[model samples]
Target: MGSTIFTPFSQKELIPKEEKLEIYRRERKLCIGIPKEISIDENRLCLTPDAVQVLVNAGHRVIMERGAGEGSFFTDLQYSEAGAEILENRKDVFAQSLIIKINPPTLEEIEWLQPNAYLISALQINLCSKEYFKKLSDKKINAIAFEYIMDEYKQFSLVRLIGEIAGTISILYASEILAQTNGQMLGGITGVRPTEVVVLGAGIIGEYATKAAIGLGASVKVFDNSIFKLRRLHTIVDNRVPTSIIDPKELKKSLRRADVVIGALPRINQLPIITEDMVSTMKKSSVIIDLTVDSGKCVETSELTTLSNPTVIKNGIVHCGIPNLTSKMSRTTTKAISNFFLSYLLEIDQEGGFENQLVKCQEMKQSLYMYKGRLTKCTIADKFGMQYHDINLLIF
Candidate 1:
């Protein structure tokens, strides 16, 4: 009774005032670095001159390795005009807090990173190993893979753009190969049979390849294991192209007569659609562009080749398995990639900073494959036999 009498009115019984937290918006000044790519046949640049200008205008420091953008036809004067400091020594560029590039850093490049630095580049998962993760972990670096970067719609924006470029280039390269083999054009000619183009996989690359092939007046047939993707491709191509399930008999029959065979199959599957025996049946001098070769060959006889020596004759078929076809059109690809990255960097400024943005943006969080050197992507971790940590747990 004495305690009850001494107790004041409980705050829970009364209407309590709402406690408001103060929100501070401070400009995040980041030292962003662009390193020259030394990987085999990588020509794409992460940012363009215009992108550098925008970042510089936002009060962020931009450091570029001398000649970093030369592969994409961007001059040092252009980047300098956009307010970037050009450093001749690569180690100086790598000293920046944020590193961006096209290919995943080589082990030597990773050694150049400072502790807690952020790395943005392609993951190249098939080329990655446990040692890669261990190296990044040892250095306590954060890594983001462009392939995992997503948009508001949960679609892979970078992958789709690159796929479109690859698809268009694939058909064009095939046409060149066809001309090299026999002095024949890819499309229909009066009284001449149109080039028979058989495309495997009806995904993004296959869709664009079909469009390009059909536009050039080639007889195009697309095959996919997924009826949904095949149907989707049919609608995307205005219902004109022939679409079919990947029946072995029909596929082999097509292969025997096809002037160009495009292997645009998705990388999820490790098995090849066209085996050695099927490839051998193809017409001599036929061109096979296996765009999916990087992940795993879509044609059994196709081997990974560098841009310098991109084609090999296997069973009389010219197999071109260049992993990065987009690099052939480096300028256009660089512009597209720069646009994506500019928006991303601007968002970081608007959202306060990377850590805060990761907390607020689901898309940003999803794109982060590694945080503070810990493996955060389950698929990559599992594939490389490394321990996986939930990014959310590590972030907070």
Candidate 2:
């Protein structure tokens, strides 16, 4: 009875006490690595020279593989000038604790990673194998995917930015190819008919493509299976453009007169709505830009057109299905990506690095597909037939 009555809590209940504070651990100098992209389709760098400068100035160590920035016109000297150590050994760059890239690391590159290393890159899960993920788990890596990275509004920050670029460029490239092929302009002239632009899908890529076509004075007609998205796109453009559901007959009829067809459909169904027969119905030399070719072909006849041979002719229609459309504007895309990453790195720095940041940031947690060698993304796990672990369970 005496022991039960002499408790510290019983005494504290009657006594005034100071509040306890959460003291964060000491901040550590982050060592980040940038490896040169070996993928032919990926020509954009994750961080630019300016971004490296900011990180270096903040007492962080930056290691860059030699020739890492050449694709974006950022020379090794530029990165060196920004205080990054230029490492000729690719393996050495990958040895750092944190690695960033435009593309997901190749299976070989994953083997180069050290145990418990942190990775930030595009997670093109479509291109990855079960073996690739197993290697990551074996190394006990922490991986974040750019596609899952969210902003304050819960929208994908990096993906939307790249989608915006892709949308605008689709119209621009179409106009250029149209002008060169048939000497027809995108806009209407006093004596000439208005250029008819047909756009598929009403998502981010399609929305901005419609806006761009309208801005260039082209007559834009948008089609989508979703009435809501179509209606939203109509309102987004001030109800100035005509909208329709993706009816085969109506779409085929419109294709006959379309001067440019922008294919912005994603691979939700994995089947092309616009068939080869429908593509054949379009006007000869009409430009078709399949922005979602990387996901899957929206146009049945669209082919993989590389920079060397930028356009392919199928059924007498000019088709451009370059998957890495944003890479065409490499410098601009790199800078935008770098700006987003700069703030992300700085926040992690202030939070005493990845471990503490993992506990605090919801976005960071959401972006991670792998946490300390455990699979956290159900979508990826399901696709690859792998065991899934909850990030909440693993992080703590």
Off by more than 4 A, model 1: 1-19, 22-27
| Candidate 2 off by > 4 Å | 1-18
The residue-by-residue lDDT of candidate 1 on 182-254, one tens digit each, is 8879999889999999999888889899999998999999999898998788778875788789899999998
TM-score of each: 0.92, 0.89
* Candidate 1 C-alpha error for residue 207, in Å: 1.2
Instruction: Give me candidate 1's TM-score against the actual structure.
Output: 0.92
lDDT of 2 at 275: 92
Residue pairs of candidate 2 with colliding backbone atoms: none
lDDT of 1: 0.87
Taking the tens digit of each residue's C-alpha lDDT, what string does model 2 give over 35-149? Answer: 9988875679989898999999999999999999998999999999999999999999999999999888888999999999999998766457799899999999999998889
* Cα error of candidate 2 at position 48, Å: 1.8
Q: Give the TM-score of candidate 2.
A: 0.89
